[model samples]
Target: MLNLSRLSTSLTKHGAHKIALLIRDHDPDKVLSLLWGKVPGINIEEVQARKNLSAGTTGLTVPSVWKEAKARGSETINALVLIAIIFSHHTLIAAMRQGAKSDFTGRITRDVELDGKAYTNFAHTLEELGYSTKHTQQYVDFDLQRLFKIPDLNSLALTLLALKMKTAGWDGTGDLKQLLIDNGFHEVFATDEDQFEAWLSSGKLTAPSFEDADYFLDAAKDSAPAGKYKFKAGHKTKQTGSVSVKSPLTKKTAQLLHNYIQNKFDEQLVAIHGRDCVGCEVATGLGTSIDVVVETAKLRWFYEIKVGKTLKACIRQAIPQLLEYAYWSAEPVKVDRLVIVAVHKLDKQSETYLQKLRDDFKLPLYYEQFVDA
Candidate 1:
């Protein structure tokens, strides 16, 4: 069985970013080339090396150096897109490894055939999913990437549904694509969850590459230049007028600030908990958006992210947004913690003021900081 009902639970945007050392920073030009052999800036030798490495094996990956190139790319980076492509790369590898090397000549019988042979239910399922079309590596890449789109895990659920039903000797009564879109979509993953959890415990499928990210991710960051380095201004969408000022937001700076939050704060929480519980730009129904919202078994936290502000100023601007949305939203909401995130650490005076708010005023406020890498 191919159970992936819980697949998106622990897969975070940042965790995906660290899946493969060979994966680039998602320069916009090469973002579409996330497939194994299709990526630019990598040599044939590097491709073969990655291919030869076994699934789930732990070692420092040796991908081609791409540091200098990222510094020179044209398009400004979107952190979300970067992680999306990272996840795409691993999805391709996982499917190919299993389809090519796994010994499970699957049990379900199929009505279709592919490549004139290798016509087990497994191969047939791949075919019906369009994985066997053209039989070129490119088609396989397309089919695999077509499986999962981050922030929308239904594609993943449908892919898994097709695989499972086909393997269980599905009679081919309905079109696979129609069977998916026609159903109550959330109900689709919900209703089948525990029924397919057995596959997870029995080790029937390989864990995703983003799982158990216990390796070093900060190596490149450690070597990266210390900050105050200037960015050429690109676009400015700074929240001005009455909404929120006190800080200016340029396109590149906004990207960099968001990238920092995802990497430093968001990734750590997700590694311990899961991605399904974390959200960015979360709407609070009170005509406001939160920077990040992380929910766990015991707690739900609302984060307000501010960059280019001093510790005092960041806290000042963040408090109003956090309080207004968390308490006065359209519905009942529980806020376990309120975090003020900035680029600078709090001075003693600022720390004492925050502590006073927490202890004396009974606010669940806290502070977090992330300096440039």
Candidate 2:
């Protein structure tokens, strides 16, 4: 597998300033022409080779080169956009190499579709700069996907922006937002700006997060007609069953049973060990919060509390969660036991599975079922 961290580091080492210089030095028309394969004499591979040579030989980094560019009154927005384009090409190369040995066909196909649309829209914007519709459409249909073999330009721009934010903290000055808008990414920033900003602030811009965001944007666009599209800047709401909750009795019963079982466990632990068991909800840093963590004198117990109609149902719901909690905890070895606490005893099949996990897999995991008073 391609280590994304190493790839990101390699991209950063390539120096965004040198990329900006390459864009600033060339005419926008020629740059677009080179990108679209209009310039027969200059191809992307030759341009990339030259860029690698310049980046390696020059001692200048992104910050220093950016400073020099600013001194010379270079347009920062254009530079950022052009750098994003270059980064997208490099990312496609890396992704293709990695996908060659694995099953990334579905992901690659989705990226190509979404990014193809974004690239087409971008080409529409470039029409003002002298690209005809025929030429732009031809480039989008033939050269863009065929040559780069990745997603569209807009997502590439977003990914580059996210990488920048990850490496260099956002200043909240709206410069990055403006840069995106100026370069045909108005859809991302058009609506729900505050929500998008909050998401960015949460520091959860993993590869999956970017993919989720892209999926959301694409879905929203598909649901709306052209020129009337409204892009929401967050995840899609999860669909839930339409089961009726006629009364609050079920909820209250579950809550009371949960408390009773927790108290019983605490009392039992204290009576046996002569020390109070500390119960707390712990954040596991893996996008999940452990429901109840009980730390006693000699052992740390990770518990997934569930109140289902049957013990088997509860155990089924809690098994993966309990295992994940135990594995992703700050100190997994310190967690001596993983327990699934429910309101009833497990069925035979559930018991067998738990035993197999404990005996065969040597997992320190088990189930604890408690009766409701």
Candidate 3:
């Protein structure tokens, strides 16, 4: 995703190392060494060794769109153009937004066709963010490294390409002959000649779907985040006094964290309760939905998710929403407890504020913090 403000600082401070972290889950250092140590010209051993644990991986899932692309590729396209487009999308966006150079969409305007079309501001912020891992290294052997068993970057790229085309107004079934021109690298999308023509006319070729493409999956670990959770606060039984320090919030960074937190909370609830009883994003009768709702024979819980820099900010936003969701309608949804799920726990002062809400008004509201596991 194009969180350009923080991304600029991240790249300048850490080089490709931080971005590489988001692009891999299992021993990213191993991939770094392979790409850098093995090739001295582009070697980045020093970059690989710098340990900045704060540069965490993006928690995302593999969108189903890539599955269809992979399946259709056996006939029409090979891996090269597919891979080229990945780096292309990342670089092209960078070129347009961050003033970085790109091979496909040259320095602002070497190609007139894209010159009028490729301005950064014209693209919606969400469109710019889709399928991006915040950054991509424009290496020639991008496909080789992607095929080396990592799914984070590739999944993001194809989905990104689709967004770019949608912005450019290219049709899925449109003639791709103009796209088949030689940019000096073995003829673009020329992996299968006979099948390319067949696919061109057959209209079976598909682009990566935008749905769920925002997730950056950690394919190495079944989409689980690295490191054990530092602290957790949900109910008084599992609560802890300690809280996480404030972290930065970019538009893309916040969304990635929010989705990851929601999914993790879903898993935790299922483990504590049971799948049949736990419902996520359940729509209430009021036409609004709760992030995570749990129902047992005896009681029910309404959960609201809020990700913010401070516990106070999260609580302020979550409390009102939970209240309205629980009591807004005449036939209000049954709720024994109203819980708030957030990124950090309360500080002493903030904890006192929440306690007063409980003691004075006797609100059945509770607090919970999300941590990596």
Q: What's the TM-score of every candidate structure?
A: 0.32, 0.31, 0.35
Q: Rate the local accuracy (lDDT) of all candidates.
A: 0.41, 0.42, 0.43
Give per-residue lDDT, candidate 1, residue 24: 36
The residue-by-residue lDDT of candidate 3 on 1-373, one tens digit each, is: 2221222111122123222222232233243334444533333333222211111233223334434334444221223223323223333334333332222121232232123223231121112322222321221111122221222333433343443343344465543332331111111222233222223333222211111122212113333222321112232122212322243343444555566666777778888887777777666544445778788788888887776545775786678778866765655566789998886765788777778888899777888777666
Model 1, stretches more than 4 Å misplaced?
A: 1-255, 330-332, 371-373
The global Cα lDDT (0 to 1) of model 3 is: 0.43
Encode model 1's per-residue lDDT on 278-372: one tens digit a residue: 76666655434566778767878887776533466567667866776566534547788999887776789988988999999888999987543
lDDT digits (tens) for residues 1-373 of candidate 2: 1122322222322222233344556543233233334433333443342342223223333333333333434444343344443333434333333222211111222244324544443333223222122333434211121111222323334445655443333443555644443333222222223223323333221121221233324433222222211111111122223322121114344455554455555555445544445443455554444555666556677776665545665666677667755554344545678888765656788888888998998887788765433
At residue 113, give the lDDT of candidate 2: 30
TM-score of 3: 0.35
Give the local distance difference test score of model 1.
0.41
Best by TM-score: 3
